[model samples]
Target: MIPPKGKPLSDFPSLPPGFRFGTSTAAYQIEGAATEDGRGPSIWDEFCARPGTIADGSSGAVAADHYHRYAEDVALLKGLGAHGYRLSVAWPRVQPAGEGTPNPKGLDFYDRLLDALVEAGIEPMVTLYHWDLPQALEERGGWLDRATAERFAEYAGHVAARLGDRVAHWVPVNEPNVTALLGYALTAMAPARGLSFDALPAVHHQLLGHGLTVQSLRASGAASIGTATNHTPVWPASDDPADHEAAAFYDLLWNRLVADPILLGAYPDGFAELMPGPVADDLKIIASPLDFYGANYYNPTAIQAPGKPSAPATATAAGHVEVPSDLPFQFAPMTGHPRTDFGWPVVPEGLYELIMQLRERYPSMPPLYITEQGCAYNTPPDADGVVDDSARVAYYDAHLREVARAIADGADVRAYYAWSLLDNFEWAEGLTQRFGLVWTDYETLRRTPKRSYHWFAELIAAQRA
Candidate 1:
């Protein structure tokens, strides 16, 4: 059963003055019209076309119809009293072939969206790449090749030159670790390459792309620049030395590999030596200063050395995918904790621990932002026509409390953007997962606010007050 909403603003944790509260959406996840406005096909488009790729046998071809109803979505944001709106400018939308000419029609759509956001008093934060690599670039070696990094810089420059004036916050890339590890190394995500540990080059190239694009965004006179990295705490399954060592290695691979280069201008110990190309030279580019650091936290993961404790992972309300046991470290399920619809344990303290770790690990860590944090739950409308997602409200409240605790402990977190504004097309899981605060009737494409939406709106109003 879903938990009930807690209390009013006075009873909840207080955030600092001018701290941003917003919602996020990715291009391939929310923006439909995949083939319209001369938009070139993306890797996601290709992946979805293949049978058995998306669980629901559905694609983002129509999505929530946000491409045609962005105004309505903007209105939703304004009504929620959002201080910011984090969105991605589809690379293929701007440069259909990933290089060469810019698509005027594609740029026009974002121009209108930005103008509307500004009119609604919402700060627009633009993310350059969000897992939707144009198929043209993928065909030519994708992130594995150095040329893709150069082409990415060119593409960033194109969008920044046009929208840089209005958009203050610029994210060059989002969750490169997820893209390289899942999409390239593992078979879970798009462009399902499944190269396993051999996909190290993709990681380096993505970071290189980020660094190059940071320079491009700067040249375009963008004010605030950052990249969203997916982060989570790694816990050992037991006190055994092998378990601890395996957990440490997994941490180095999952967290430190990409983060160290960006925040500290170096990779985790020997990992850098393994990355392809002139890594020493690339580190200088990868370590470019960021105005802020964006972290997307889900939950902490427990690990054990391979071939130890083969307990079956209990499926949650929505089930979960099993981790490959052949890896150096095996994932052990968190035994006792509330879970979301995605079978992820609801460990809000992990967010606090992650922020504190960043503070302690990197002395030069930029101001932090909870760029993406939210859960997926099947809390559709009830018989009274109300989507009373008290579970989501509790989830937000608990996480915000943790954020407030971190702030009190002197962590410089400045923003929190929920993972999504509306429930549209969830990648891989397809329509099975609903992470939005607003419910969408996919058939009629009608938008309906859930109970969590109102709860969040009230909190935003109280913050301003």
Candidate 2:
């Protein structure tokens, strides 16, 4: 259960020394100026242009105006007492066509942002790509083509050459599985293709891109490199054998498929045969050792055999990826847990379970970071201009306790980055979901620090003390 609002930080479990606190934001989701300063269009730009594709028929063309107001956002981060900030570099922005000469103005934007972050004494964790594939690349078959992965390595080299000196940590890709599954197989996100399981090529190419990016960053003098993959504990709907099998498959696809290649240097038996290219050679690159492993967790998922009566009507019925009925598995709602505004189950213990599972599953796993963890609560600023999002405060409180618990059990957890620092464009959901500690007025692009923001600032202060 969520603790009541105003609960003191002293009541929560203590974190170990050097446990960093930070916040994460994606480029397409927050950094607007889609077509500004020679910026080429991304697949999302085209995706949002399609009628009825986005929930609110909204586009991120001017999202939060972060491109113009990053300094203001940096001030908020400093005020929040964040030790580090994780931000993604827009691929199209750096290379408008995802290739050829890098755009000077585009690189200048990040140069200024990183400068501000360093000046404020905050460490910068830069993710090389966050699903904003250049439209030019997508037109050339995107991740489905091996050339795209090669292009990504080139792109990574360009960014590292310019900013490697400033970025303390490098994440090559943000949630590659989600990109392949949602955008390629499910057709629910950008560059929608609805290729179903046939999207396996996209998966292989993305992992290859990640491995290649890691090499590029290292060659450019990147000292710290890691991943930010979304993970969930898959629960079977019932005791039936079919349900158990389906759950195992979903777990393998959602969790192990991306991780085993990186951590174990091998795919879960026989799966490598499905990928294109020289599987053995690519796995060698994909398995490059990392300095740390980042897990982006929200909640546990329940899975059941396809065609079950209890299955959700659509894959995204639970506000996640869409699952076609023809698939071997289906999504089921978890019961008895509080639900976020996005309808994701609030199973804080899932975070603990995932950390421990990672430790046991891959003994050689590097230190872990909770790169993204937060709930969506669209609590508007009440009349006095104060946004009191107590539910979100409680959510963080409960989750942080689990992080502490994992540490007590000997997980080498290093950091916790809230999902975002400000409410911004939410992709297909547009501005419909608010996951930020700072509430954003879309109409005015003004940021108001919510009650949870102050609560977290105090938590960070108390931790440092």
Candidate 3:
């Protein structure tokens, strides 16, 4: 890994031809006109209202005001010199009830935004959903109900029909595993945070939605289609058989759970039995083929053997994976690595390891992209409107070099987009954390690109040159 110091783009490693560098943001996280332009309230709008749901007691009510300041945001995108911008469609804004006629105003907002992005010299990469389900859908069992899959196709059709003309790259869903685990098994931190063994259906239906959506988009002439998943390496902590078994279980859930279906067109063996329902039919839809794969990687996991007969999951609030408590391999904090403020390990080499595994395993693996890569540092602003967020800058510099290294190693790593363009409403943590290279003055709805912005801009320019 490159040393933890802010490095300019010229100092970074070389990338291949047509390798595009970009930045990403989401609807609910940045566009804060909660009630603007006929947009309906999302599950997050209500979720944040319930006291203690968000750490800062803040909601996306008036986030970065991207709704009104989008022109300025696009200008910032131009200055960053990124070729693409990834953002999500607010399901509520598109279809407030999750199944109905399209919301014209909501649709218009995106039309204008996409046009603005193109005007500013940026290609738009749209993610159909980013965990912000329309509240109406959650009322109808959300992802848990198989109907949600059908509704998602309708929504995808609406998006594709309008923007699909210019928008070629589409991600059906962002982090389906995180949506199922965090929103279901892991304590309902998101909308429909229903923690029941029954939530297994939610996982199946979500993947089904991804598969069906891909089919729908393919039929519509989408040249490229894929989904984003978060992955990490699982290591057995000891030589014991139990720990080995435990590590295998962790790998199945974290890695294969989402990938096997898209690549192999089936679920991992025995995964169906662990799931709640008889998924014979659902598996058919779950294992849909795709043109590419996107992985949102952060850190690796160490697992010991299992104490219990079943392989328990580790989606609880403690950040602990349930392995055999007294077995050979045990989950522990990342060693020999620095941790982020959220206590996530900052291991850039893990990114290299992740890319290599994908290449060696999936023979049909599509071009890999780092969909979301950035860190949260408490970067407070100064009077000059500039955030000297050197920590975040350093974090990104180290990660980007590893990305180039992966490209050099035949990983087919095509693009690297920073997690965000501006600080807005971070889920669970709310506005308490900042992950953007540009600082958002929530009070004024003003955006100031940080030093990392200029550094990355120069880097992108140099890489392209």
The model with the greater TM-score, 1 or 3, is 1
Clash number for candidate 2 = 1
Question: Can you tell me which runs of candidate 1 are displaced by over 4 Å?
Answer: 1-3, 310-322
TM-score of 1: 0.97
Worst 10 residues of 3 by lDDT: 315-324
> Which has the higher lDDT value, candidate number 1 or candidate number 2?
2
Q: Candidate 1 residues 36-79, lDDT tens each? A: 99999999999999999888899888899889999999999999
Order of candidate numbers by TM-score, starting with the best: 2, 1, 3
TM-score of each: 0.97, 0.98, 0.91
- What's the lDDT for all of these models? 0.88, 0.90, 0.77
* Tens-digit per-residue lDDT, 13-81, candidate 2: 779999999999989888889989999999999999999888898888988889999999999999999
The lowest-lDDT stretch of 10 consecutive residues in candidate 1 is 314-323
lDDT by residue (369-420, candidate 3, tens digit) is 8888777776777786677877777888887778888878778888887888
Number of backbone-clashing residue pairs for each candidate, in the order shown = 0, 1, 8
Candidate 2 residues lying further than 4 Å off, grouped into runs, are: 311-320
Better of 2 and 3 by TM-score: 2
lDDT of 2 at 197: 84
Q: Candidate 3 — number of clashing residue pairs?
A: 8
